[model samples]
Target: MNKNTTIEEVFQNHERPKKPGALNASATFAWRALLRIRYVPEQLFDVTVFPIIFLLMFTYLFGGAISGSTGEYLDFVLPGILVMTVSMITMYTGLDLNKDIEKGVFDRFRSLPIWRPSVLVGALVVDAVRYLIASTIMITLGYILGFRPEAGFFGVILAVLVLLLFAFSLSWIWTMLGIIVRSEKALMGISMMLLFPLTFLSSVFVNPTTMPNWLQVFVDINPITFVVDAVRGIIHGTDAMSDILMVIYISIGLIVVFGPLTMYFFRNKN
Candidate 1:
């Protein structure tokens, strides 16, 4: 306890922490994220209110112009909107991590005795729940707006799972950004700037064939387009082998690239 204590003595006196298993450590952090949600219930707004607003607005505003009737457009757009909404909400993983870093909690967490990546994994688990809530709202409201999925309830569930898997993979990219960025605002800005163009420019809003030839090239290759197409296939009970495979490939590619990069920065960042 002396002020003159040497570094060697300090090291000798310090007790090493017993490390928890990966799943246990991650569950701890996941529980912490869920508890924070209870105190800050506004966190639910994006997955709830925002999805509703986007659904109603897009369904009514452009529905007739795009598909000849609101009902017709609702059927076409609902799957796309669901994909976009869940994708947008994935940014929160980065925003929350940035805030934690700024507030100094991230450093404290780093000092804790646990699997390091569990912190990231745990937060991701919570975000998955948020995505589920958003998906449910979009599908339920779509029904009210006459957007029936011919594939029925079971099909809708499959669509939701596919979107969640893609969103989970996408979160790794944001998780890396959150570790690298100086502020939550910067992370949000950069993420939105990238996501808006990808989602809007894809087949989400209109048919790719209707797009200009040049623009159609991008739409045809866009990952969001693949996800939207897969969802539409699931909802309509159609064969979507190519779309589903593409979505899976995109998700795996994201995780393979960003997952390690995020952990590298997370472990080494000052």
Candidate 2:
């Protein structure tokens, strides 16, 4: 036998396929995605700056007009502003996903041995960190501006957790929209089109009682309003248990409905 034939035969007899563990695969993918964010941190500034600017502008411009006193209105509007900021930043999930698809990033992912779900999970985890940072900044800014949460530290923490849960669940909807859309611009347009009505029609800037009867009904039913109201109650200790329960139920329902659908579509698109 030739020297090359002898070496090939020897290795071929001992060679065995190596199987990747589920945990290893997931960790590797998660690390890769996290490192991407670490390398490109400017992406996070959008979440940080927008919330601060909005809070300041609205608090100064309309705070007095809305609540008759800037200090009183800041407390009332801060919770709603927090919710709106989180929701707005979450829209970036779709835009990022759309860009990745357009740039053939999914194809690069396909060439890897990682589990399919790992990709989406990696993205979600990275975005969740951004959301947490943004939330903290908004809350701290509110505090500096005389927005006190009478519910104390523990209650404030719980409220933050609830808001994060709501934001995470809502991200699935935007993630799906981003994947289905052809361009990042289109994705942004579509997400904003849906977000505008949802944001404005809720009890965000103005009290629902100030609206017409029909508008009040819609605002009362809007899920974002419940989230805002629940956070407000947790901070102020003024809202009822029934309202908090409603928010929890609606958030859970959204996760159940959209979470699986997002995964299904993401998998198929990949």
Candidate 3:
């Protein structure tokens, strides 16, 4: 062949780039998101600080009025505070997703030779570490504040697992909202508006018995109530198998509903 023909053949015969492995795509995105957390540790402040503040504020300010003594109320309130903290952390899933979308991060990811779904699932996985850290701090704070878990170490761990599972399931819902909403601030506002009422309307601060019959009925059916009660049962030796089952079932249902919905939206957006 002539020199020019040989050069053209050489260029044409060069190997094409290989696609990234599925597992590699997932792991790369997961680790990249997680490493970002180390650089911006302040993202964790709300997770650690909010629980402590809420625990102390509620126990000291209204404990006696609500439960007859600060000590007695701490026992009842800690579980609710723990659940609230997990719920608050889930809001970040949507907020961060919205921020990424706004910044064209998803478009950048699309250009990569990786599984597109990995970007979302990996973010959710990485955020679980933050969830664990927040949970450990909250549980430790409870222990230091004279809140004892009658369920012992294993039960406490189990309760934490359940709480995290619930958080993970809820993340999908927030992920969908984050992608659907046009702005991060709007996502945060809407999430908090929905969460605040769900949390407060339940038996978090006061006994449901004190509420009106109509409100009491609603509180009884709130999923957050079931989660809080399950945690309290595990820690305080209250029989909560039924409540635990309810939480498990509801969490599974949420995953079933939101997981597919998120994937659908994500694919369409891409």
Considering every candidate listed, which one attains the maximal lDDT? 1
Q: Model 1: which ten-residue window has the lowest total lDDT? A: 10-19
Model 2: per-residue lDDT, tens digit, 1-270?
A: 466687668777866557666666767766876787789978878778988998999999998888889999898888888888888888887777778788898778767766776766667777777888888898899889888889888877878888888888888888888878888888888888888888878977888999999889889888888888888888887864776788678778877998788778877884
Global lDDT of each candidate: 0.93, 0.81, 0.87
Question: Candidate 1, clashing residue pairs?
Answer: none
Q: Tell me the deviation in Å of residue 57 in model 1.
A: 0.6
lDDT of 3 by residue, 4-62 (tens): 67766878876877888878888888898878788998888888888889889999999
TM-score of 1: 0.93
Worst-scoring 10-residue span by lDDT in model 3: 1-10
By TM-score, the candidates rank as: 1, 3, 2
**What is the lDDT, from 0 to 100, of the residue 204 in candidate 1?**
88
Poorest lDDT segment (10 consecutive residues) of candidate 2: 14-23
Residue 81's lDDT within candidate 1 is: 91
Scored by TM-score, the top model is: 1
Q: What is the lDDT of residue 189 in candidate 1?
A: 94
